[model samples]
Target: MRILIVSWEYPPVVVGGLGRHVHHLATELAAQGHDIVMLTRRPTGTDAVSHPTTDTRVDGVRIIATAEDPPEFEFGRDMMAWTLAMGHSFVRTGLRVLAGERNTPEQQPWVPDVVHAHDWLVAHPAIALAEFFDVPLVSTIHATEAGRHSGWVSGPTNRQVHSVEWWLATESDSLITCSASMRDEVTRLFGPDLPDVSVIHNGIDIRTWPFAPRPVRSGPPELLFAGRLEYEKGVQDLLAALPRIRRTHPGTTLTVAGTGTQQEWLVEQTRRHRVTKAVRFLGAVDHQGLVGLMHRCAAIVLPSRYEPFGIVALEAAATGAPLVVSTAGGLGEAVTDTTTGLTFDPGDVAGIATAVRAALGDSAAAATRAARARDRLTEEFSWSEVAERTAGVYLAAKRRVRHPVGRPSIPERPLPERDPGQSD
Candidate 1:
């Protein structure tokens, strides 16, 4: 299969989980003997005029980055402009590739069998290219604007984003989401007329995150919270729980990783709670650093108020870090309370503190759960499985495009329920 992927983010320029997901999915598809072409935004400072399109190969996948610098403006007006520019650039570069102007002797020009897009940022280009080439469009809605804002669409920028999301859903032949909760959210927004939405959970490559063996902690144990330090991320809830956590487990330290708009506010809150000395804000840590932190920490906490699917939970579990996550959105589905790890109600500071204390106090049981979670990750959430399932969606979309009449409807199959004994 020849697949063309249009996304706003890719490696070395990743702002969030979408880039990492696209990188691994494309690479894995290429490894499975399929041709993959990725069109994403160029990194900052790259001369757009001189290098309108930059091509590179990573792990057998060809990446074509088009120059589309974000505009400076308040609200999401800049994003609106960026999306338009990105779409225009994608269409321009895609035309060149289709004409063999950008291909080498070994790799001849070929029309993509399917055009897969990630999120609304690249929806315009994906829809345009699919129509131009008469190919099936497969869209993956990683998250939605309404979901991010708790179903409150505010301002022109947000309304525009929401409109684009709706357009993408209606235009695409098939849709993919990271969780069942997200699948329902998309259905509610787009209605029953929308294309079949498949639930494929985000996966992690366990081998890439090499686990470090840490000896039993004789001193104060460490609790790590990684992700954007935003209100939606529920980092503030974690901060609020620190005082209660320390009362039971004195001298326990907390390490907050990742940077976001709420960093300053979170710092202030720590001072107000008088737990400033016990918390360390590492801002953003590199991949290896994060894996190391996961290994060293006694438990990894994810207190998200609205997580579509907590990829961090999978990463922490893969590294054998005991998990404590909020029962918010798809997080509860990700971690089986008391089995894989523990879960608490979102924003319940006392519940979070209790889960953290239980996890830290019973090191043996926590370690057992962590080990089970890692095994489950390999069995259920491996990239190979995800790629296979995604490829299935592509094939289904193509079949539907080829035979529109008397075509069987794409089934609403949620990902297999989380199982401890599932095999890879």
Candidate 2:
């Protein structure tokens, strides 16, 4: 199958989980014998005069970066301008590929069997290309603007992005969400006219992450939080719980890894709570540094008020790290409370404190749970399985497009069994 993926971010230009998701999915699909071409924004420092659009390959997948430099202006206006520029570039690239001008005599024209778009940022281009080629369009809604702002569209920017999200959900032949919670949210926002939605969980390559044997800690217990330092992320709530956490587990320290708009406010909260000395804010750490921190920390906490799918939780679990996650959105679906990891209600300071103390105090039990969580990663959330499920979605979309009437529903694929002796 020939597949074309349109996303706003890719390798070396990622802002969050979406970039990594696309990268791994595309590469895995290509490895499975599919022709994959990824279209994403061009990173900084690329010579536009020499290469207006750059084409590169990684692990058998082709990546094309065509977006122009972003404008320096207001946030909302800049986003609108960037979307238009990206759409224009997609059109140019789509035309060239459809024309078969870039193909050799023996090779066929680079026409895609399916066009998949990630999030609303690339919705315009995805829709346009799908319409032009008369092919099936599949969209993956990683998260929603409405959900991010707690069902409130505060301003023009919020309202505009929400509108785009609705458009993309309604227009796509098939919609894919990272979690069942996200699928429900999409349906609630878009009404009954929305297409068939599929839930495909985000996955990680566990073997790539370095996991050293966690040594028994004799000093103050270290708790790690890694994600965007924002209000919705519930980092402030974690700060609120620190006082109580310290009361039970004296001298406990918190290390936050990641940067966002709420960094300054989080710093202030620490001072207000008088736990300033106990908190260490490490702005942002690379993958290697994060893995190192994960292996060292007593437990990893994800106190998100709204998480579409907790990919970070998967990363933590893969490292055999004890977890304390909030029962918000898809997080509850990801971590099985008590069995794999413990759960707390979002923004519940008492609950966060209790869970953290439990994880820190019970070394034997925590290690057992962490090992189970790692086993779950291999059993259910491997990239190879996710890519295969995604391919099923594409096939279902194509079938639906070809035969509108009496189209059968795509059944959920069962989880594949993992060999006990196999690694990753």
Candidate 3:
């Protein structure tokens, strides 16, 4: 199979788990004897004049990293304009590649059997390229704007993003989600007439995250929270539970290893909770550093209030870290209560404290659960299994009739469609 995977981010430029997901998936697919081409962007403010497109190959996948257009556009601040610029660049690069403009003896022009897009950010380019090439378009909805807002499209930007998400869902031949919970969410949000929705749980290859279990643990008892400091990530809830956790187990501290829009707010929160001294905020630690923290910490906590599928949970579990996670969204499916690790309800500060205390107080049980979680990784969450399932989705997508690419024929909502000719 020849697969063209489009995403806004890739490795060395990861904002969240989506980039990691795509990176592993593309590499694994290429290893399975399939030709894979990854289309992504260079980081912000990169020189598009000197080098418009960069071609590189790593671990069997051919990656084409395109630079952002000139006349500077910041991502979050310039949302819609930036997206349009990126789509135009993608179209240009895809056309050049297909036309053999940069063909050499070593690298020949290629056409993909299927075009798989990661999220709504690259929807326009993916839809256009798939239509132009007459190949099946498969969309994976990593997360939705409405889902992030707890089912409310609050502002204009949020509503626009939601519309684009709906457009991607409507335009693709088949839909894929990281978890069954996410699949259900897609069906509920994108609704009555969607192409077959498939659930392909995210996978992790533990071989990469090598860890030697700590012999003599250093410093105070540490709990690790390694994800974006966002409201949905539930990091604030973890801070709220810190006082109670320290009550039962004195001098217990937390190590946060990520940054986000809520970093300043979360910092303020630690002060208000009066556990400021106990909490150490290490914003955005590298992967190796995070794995080391996982190995050293008493427990790895992922208190996600709206996780599509917590891949970090898999990473932490792979390091033999005792898992303490909230049973929200796919976290419920990922971490089995008591078997793999301890589980709690989302936003339940008390449950978090209790779970953490248990993991800390009972060393033997925590170690046992940690071992169980590590063992479970090989059987359930291997990248090989995920790649195979995704290949199956590609085959199924190829069999279906492709949807026409344009403004959707269906009604658009959350913000009603405006009259084409009437002036506001």
Candidate 4:
């Protein structure tokens, strides 16, 4: 199958889970003999003059960086303006490719068997391209702004995100979401007949992140949190729970590993709660640093209020770090109580404190459970397996587009068993 993947972010440049998801999915598809082409905005330092004003191949997959003439780098301005301008350029250039305006004998236009768009950020380009090319488009809704803010906030950026999401979901041949909760949200917002939506849970690279023997903490029992320090992530809730946690587990300490809008607020909470000494805020640790932390930590907590699919939980599970997740949104789907990890109700300070203490005290039992979780992750949610499942979705979209009616009745294959921690 020839697949053209449209996304706003890619590796060597990380915005969020969307970029990382696209990168891994594309690579896995290409490895499985699918002809893959990725379309994204040109990254920083892309030589407009030297860089092909056209298609280029990276790691056996064609990559089309948008806009032949990119804007000159300007320092000390509103970054959002620059991002919007670049996004526009990317969409315009992608539209041209889909329209077959820049075709060549050596590199023909992207006549994909499937047009797959990752998220709302690239929906404009994906929708335009699908229309121009007259191909079946499969869109993945990684997150919904409405779901993120729970309709409480509707500012300009939030509104725009929701608008694009609506357009993309309405236009797609088949829509894909990471969790069932997300599917419910989409149906509630868009009504039925919006699109033929499917749930394809996000997966991790199990081989690369095999379960290692976790290191025993010599000094303090380190409880690790690795994500954006925002309200949705429940960082504030974690911070608030720390005061009660330290009252019992004095040797317990927290090592935060990401930064976001709520950094200052989190710091304030730490100080006000007088648990600053127990918390070490290591802002934005890189991939290797995170893996190291996972191996060393006594427990890995993902207290998200609205996680579409907890990819981070899978990553930590793959490393044999017993999980502690909140019972909210997709997080409930990502942890099995006392099996893979334990769960606590969101904002239940006593429950969270109790869970943390329990996890810290029984290092040996947690290690045993972590090993089982790792085995489950590798068997059930490997990237290669998810890629094959996703390919089936692409084929389904193509078949529907090619023949709307009178097609031979085909029985749907029974989907793989929904792991207790999975979101189908």
Candidate 5:
């Protein structure tokens, strides 16, 4: 099967779990002998003369990375404008790629059997390409706007983003989500008339994670929290719990890995909670550093107020790291309360402290749970297993009969005259 995968981020441009999900899915599909063409933006800017629309292969997948045409847009600062401008760039380069304008035999035009879009960022391009080519539009809503804001889409910018997400949900023929909770969220937000949403949980490669024996040895009880430091992540709750956690377990410390808009606020929170001396903010630790921390840490706790799916928990579990996660959205589905790992309520400061203390204090129980989590990954979250289920979705999408429709036109002017640096 010939498949075209569209996403905003990929390797070297990973903003979060979405990039890793797309990369693994594309590579795994290609490994299964399917012709996979991934359309993503170049990490480094490119122009016609300098480095235009690179076509390269990695792990049997053909990656066609296009550049920002106007080259004046920045994702963080000009989010809404950047999205509209990005839609134009995607459509322009996508048409050329489909038309095989290069004329070279190797770079000749190729028709994809189905178009799979990752999220709202690439929705315009995905819809345009699918409509123009008369192919099925399969979309995966990794997370929703309302979900991030805890079902509050009150502000103008938030509403604008929500409308785009609804447009993508309505335009696509088939839909996919990372978890059952996300599927339910989409249905609740979109309507009673949307198509069936397939629930395909995120995958992890155990070989890369490489499980280790995590017996709680004698050392500082270091609890690791790895993810974006956003409001929805509930890192503040973790900080609030730190002081209480220290009452029971003396010499306990926390190592925070990652950075976001809430970094300063979270730092202030640490000072307010008087855990400034105990908590170490190691902002934006790389994957290598993160894994090392996970192996050595007594336990990893994820106290999320709104988590569609906890991919970081899976990564930690694969490394035999004991998990103490909040029962928020799909996080509850990711870890069983007593079987695989300990669970707590979202934003519950006392719950967070209790769960962390449990994992830290009990060496035998923590090791047992961590081992169970590592074992669970092989059965349910392997990359090959995830790819096969994803392939099934593509096959079903290909079988759908699409009606001829006009492509969505990109506006000449950007979304707003002024730049609003707001995005999820």
Candidate 6:
């Protein structure tokens, strides 16, 4: 199938997990004998529009990037202005791709078999292109504002984000989510009209993250936490757990990775606990260094308040590091208790310490679990499997669009029971 993917971020310029997700998906699709073209917003480069891009060919698939250049608009510090700019850029790019596809003859058609878009950031373009080309559209909702806030308050910004999500779910032919839990979130937030949401769990490229012999910790057992440090991420809770954790295992050290707004609070928490020396604040390590550290660590911990699907856990699991994650959103789906890794309540500092200590205490057992983790990643979370499932969703979407003449339109019915981590 000739698939056109519209995303906001790509490799070497990732704002969040979405970028890496799209990157691996496209690569895997190419490997499966599908032609893939990516339409994404250019960071800040003034160069050729249809230039050679990342991992363009795999197996029989051909991939390319169609960069969108939006004229700079002064928002004057208004949040709405930023939203408008994003919308305009997406809409304009979608229109451009559609027009180009239409101009070409059917014998050598540029029109895509399916238009698959990654989030609200690229939804405008995806919707616009589908309308212009009259092609089926599939949208993947990664996370929602409600999920982010955890129901504290639904402010205007939150509403705007929700509004865009609603528009995409209503406009697209099919909806895909990372977890069954997310499928429920979509139905609850966007109403039951979403034509049977599908769950396509997130996956990692296990091959790229090659395992090497890790260095024995000359000093203390190293523990690593990577991601945006925030209240929702439960980094502060991890710090609170650290003091208790050290009393039991004094040789253990915690390494906090990634940067976010909660840096000050985390720093203060370390000071308040007086375990600043034990906690190494390694803010924002890149892909290579982070994976390398994972291989050598006692365990990789993620104490998130809520996670749609934790990709970091998969990486750590793939590298054979003992995994410890919070029972947040879809994270529970990723890490198996006492098999691949351990889990604790997002808010329970004591529980987190217990899980962490348990993972580190049984060195032989952890090694066994680590081996199982790497094996599980290969059996379940490979990119090839992810791409095939995504392709099936696109095919189903196309089938729905083609057979819309006689039969009753498939009413977007919400699932009877909430299924977390349910992807097509």
Per-residue lDDT for 333 in model 5? 97
Tell me the tens digit of each residue's lDDT in model 1 across 284-360: 89998998899899999999988999999999988889999998888988899999999999989999999999998
Report the C-alpha lDDT of model 3 over 309-346, residue by residue, as the tens digit.
Answer: 99888888888888999998889999999999999999
Candidate 6 residues 155-265, lDDT tens each? 455566667777777777888999888888888877655676898888888877776544565666888998987667888888889888888888678888898777877
lDDT of 2 at 348: 91
Candidate 3 global Cα RMSD: 5.3
TM-score of 1: 0.90
Which has the better lDDT: candidate 3, or candidate 5? 3
Give lDDT per model, in order: 0.84, 0.83, 0.85, 0.76, 0.84, 0.75
Q: What residue runs in model 1 are displaced by over 4 Å at the alpha carbon? A: 49-52, 69-77, 100-109, 398-424
Clashing pairs in 3: none
Poorest stretch of ten by lDDT in candidate 2 = 415-424
lDDT of 5 by residue, 316-420 (tens): 999989999999988899999889999999989999988888888787899899898889999999889989998898788742454553432222222332112
User: Looking at candidate 2, what is the lDDT of residue 275?
Assistant: 96
* lDDT of the structure predicted as candidate 4: 0.76
Question: Who wins the lDDT comparison?
Answer: 3
Model 2, TM vs. native: 0.91
Q: After superposition, how far is residue 114 of candidate 1 from its true place, in Å?
A: 0.4
TM-scores for all predictions: 0.90, 0.91, 0.92, 0.86, 0.92, 0.85
